[model samples]
Target: MSDKLTKQSIEETFRELSNWGRWGEEDEVGTLNNVRPEDIVAAAGLIRRGKVFGLGVPLDQPLQSVPHKRWNTIHTFMQDGADVATGMFEGRLQYADDAINLPTHSSTHWDALAHVFNDGRMYNGHDARRFGSKGFPVNGIEKMANRMVGRGVLLDVARFKGVDSLEDEYAITNAELDACAAAQGVEIRAGDFVLIRTGYQERFWSRGDWAGHTTGMAPGLHFESCYWLKEKDVAAVAADNYAVEARPAEGEGFSYPWHGVVIPAMGLTMGEMFYLRELAADCAQDGVYEFFFCAPPLNLPGGSGSPINPQAIK
Candidate 1:
């Protein structure tokens, strides 16, 4: 044991451990908390030494949903083909003249702490006042920004299953996650952004029906998995699924158990609909499981969640 075993030192040790097939079931969770800010800085330095990659899909119109009557679009023009007598200037000027129905409901985004709660408190022990007129302070996305720039490990679960996509209602257990990480020759660490690719982003606009077409986590995460993540002290968890957990709890009948467990109780943030294909491909090509990751959500007041344009730099 080294006396200088700061958090950063621990992260580096874990990164090496991941390459050597040392992960899970042997104090992996405890290692996350031991990660030091200096280690994160060093990891970031490595990322900057290489090429930076962006991992986000553009926001588009809704493919399927229970449409609202108020949601409609109208386009207006400031100038349309005005011909001057002498010069003959013909051009069209367009501004905010178009009002399209923005999809506020179906957001492929990161949920802020305010998004979910256990009892009534949120992250950092802030109550509704931190939220002020906005909503929940703990729910604010700002707190998460600090933890966004560490190592990120991608677990290509869909590829492991030998399919372009996982079943719509597939539930990923801790064992499955661990297995996928092992197959990829990677390990999960605290403060490390964990990305699970389910191949759903490939089907973003196939039929334009977002309802039944879009795939999410089976129901919600199993309680054990949530506990595992919390114990690991990961900065955040990103997945291609809607919620990190299964849709509904197994026996409890609640729709979102992971949210109840991770958010309010543990104060963890969940990233949804992240673009993982490119990231996964890059990881495989370079054979490097750890890379610098960055994600800063929009600082919107009173917002439950916001669209995130995240990136992973190797």
Candidate 2:
């Protein structure tokens, strides 16, 4: 065969063997967009200047279902020869602390990519390699670091319903999210860290059996909603509930399918149990949803998740 014919034959043979004709190649999704790296850095500056708002719950607050072992502590002691000076320390200095066992399945926590799997794969096509002596790759809290300084938009769902709180076990739907944003005059943007306040943050601790009283997104998170947010390129989706997705995903017979969709397929992160009472109050007073938001997770390698202190600046 001529040189050109030989090349064409090879290409055709490879395509036939690989079934390339039936496959659609698309661009892989990344974590930086509507909120750029520079944007997050700038937002950090605003937070330092105190021009932002805080949206995280106090670490010491009894907002989680941590085992009793993990509670932090302080100790004071003096150097042997330094006038017996007293110093302070916290956390279980000598023993392992387990009090803050990340709910991994409950309210107000970030789900690592290892947290779920769809078609048997984790984020960035990481497979069983995600699990090891340490844990899942990109599935732990470490991958969620430096998440501050995105354009955050709030969806005040409760306010739209004229109620301070939604019914227990309430699941937020795509329509509600859209309506809430519309009421607040905010537009969803790519790379925006979306914050949905179900007004449950206010009742935390006060509610008997703290975990039981919480609300969540309703079962059906409309695939279209996930598609929309993914298309917009959000870094993460957050809410005031424990799980970012509603319980009992549509016909899936399980809760928090949003985790599967956002994390693995879309490579998006989910933030839950965010404190929004103060942030909501400020937004209500200011009548705006655009703010500089920042969240830096504790750097704990191989940790399933980390305690986050996220803030939002106007």
Candidate 3:
């Protein structure tokens, strides 16, 4: 497109890296099409330790607030009774139901192909303006509700580089990703859900430094890494930070140009703000990088994204 992420790089990259019709004209699952039956069986074989790691941040908590335009969820709980132990029939049988007003992309969530657009087109050249307002008619998250079952590989870039974390706003290049994979002795294969940890969550969430970190910069992938993802045929890629790519890009451009290419053009799903501390710790402890990764979003049709409770079983 624009030759290595310079000016108008997003425009050209969108065209070059596109998976617009790779799966057919009506394809919706996009890169998730990489996962096959055998891949699931192979992922099951990795569950020898019976250890489970929660890969989602806790919702309705203090750390829920993020910068930019996304708003935190408002959770409201209701019980049949007026108060605890004050239920009808002497507080005996009590039940509670909760309703939540949530923004689909707020917290730990997977971005659907409809999340971005390029040249007024969505995945498979779907017109963005017409369908987007009518509710993401083509490649909404529902298409991937049943496709996210497979193996997950964690590449601890921070730990591999012998640093507590990458420098704030550092743009991680493709070479760094390869070096991390090589250092871990893990061979990334097709249909693998790759998790790139920046040590951001562990650092920011712990010290209540959300203002310093969330308000402005983040450390993540460079826009050029999209080509590497295409080459690998990776089912999906995620990170512990927002937008997967480093914020405040090097050249003058939109906020998240990588997203414009990866989601709308390439039809690839992306995850963000996953809680990977414990998972990375376990991986480093056992020197095992592959595990059964599963995270299914709500079957809400037209849902742009959803808060997920992804699990990594080792």
TM-score versus the correct structure, for each prediction: 0.70, 0.69, 0.93
True-vs-predicted CA distance for residue 157, candidate 3, Å: 0.2
Best candidate according to lDDT: 3
lDDT of every predicted structure (CA atoms)? 0.58, 0.57, 0.83
Cand. 3 TM to true fold:
0.93
lDDT of model 2, residue 58: 57
Q: In candidate 1, what residue range of length 10 has the lowest lDDT sum? A: 19-28
lDDT at 185, model 3? 94
Which pairs clash in the backbone of model 3? 1-12
- The reply for model 3, stretches above 4 Å from the true place, is 1-7, 63-68, 80-91, 132-134, 250-253
Output the better candidate (1/2) by lDDT. Answer: 1
Point out where model 1 deviates above 4 Å: 1-35, 61-64, 68-105, 119-133, 145-147, 205-209, 213-221, 250-253
Q: lDDT by residue for model 2 over 252-314, one digit each (tens)?
A: 422344454566655566777788887788778878777777676665665555556677777
Give the C-alpha miss distance for residue 308 in model 3, angstroms.
Answer: 0.4
After best superposition, candidate 2 residue 204: deviation in angstroms?
3.2
